[model samples]
Target: MKLLIRNLSRATTEAELQAMFESFGAVQSCNLVKDKTTNKSKGFGFVQMVKNGEAKAAMKTLNGKDVDGFKIRVKRAEDKPTEQPLQDAE
Candidate 1:
């Protein structure tokens, strides 16, 4: 299951997130969005867990919990809309 984590501390690292989520279960992936120019964290990230049950448990227990001085929000990630390829004008 894919989970979205929000309002993370600016100083939080991907390793920290992985470690935190790992307490509940195996984390398949932990990604922290970073700025293209400055390469700084966007204060949010996504975590992919091996199982839905573990993801739910992590979300239920971690939501609104303080981590690295921030009250983090965790939930199932919304499905992104698929983009249609643009047709070139003749």
Candidate 2:
């Protein structure tokens, strides 16, 4: 299960996020969005849990929770459709 975490604290690290969710269940992966130029946190990230139930539980306990003065929003991630170019007409 993929979880979208938003409004994360700037100082939040991938490891930190993983640890937080580890209590709920096994974490497949945890990634914290980083600024391309500054190489710093973008204040958001995604967490992947191995089980759907665990993901839901984590969301329930984590959503709207404060970390380092920032309130985090956690929810199931929406799948993004693949983009394609328009076909050329004869």
Candidate 3:
């Protein structure tokens, strides 16, 4: 299961997130969104867990919890809308 984590600390690191979630279960991946220009954290991230139950547990424990001096928000990831293919213009 995938989880969206928001309001992350500016100093949050992928390793820290992975370590935090390890207490719950196996985490498949931890990604901290970064800015294209500065390569700095966007103050948000996505975490993919091996099981849905584990993800849910992590969300419950982590949401509204302070980490690295910022209150974090965690939730089940929502499906992104698929983009339609562009039609050729005459």
For candidate 3, the lDDT comes to 0.92
Q: Which TM-score value belongs to model 2?
A: 0.91
lDDT tens per residue, model 1, 7-80: 99979999999999999999999999999999999999999999999999999999999997899999999999
For residues 1-90, write the lDDT of model 3, one tens digit per residue.
999999988888999989989899999999999999999999999999998898889999999998978899999999898999999999
How should the candidates be ordered by TM-score, best one leading? 2, 1, 3
Off by over 4 Å in 2: 88-90
TM-score per prediction, in order, is: 0.91, 0.91, 0.90
- For residue 36, model 2's alpha carbon misses the true position, in angstroms, by 1.1
The lDDT of model 2 is 0.93
Please provide, for model 2 over 3-88, each residue's C-alpha lDDT reduced to its tens digit, 9 standing for 90 to 100.
99999888888999999999999999999988899999998899999999999999999999988898899999999989889899
On TM-score, who's better, 1 or 3? 1
Ten residues in sequence with the least summed lDDT for candidate 2: 8-17
Model 3 vs. true fold: TM: 0.90
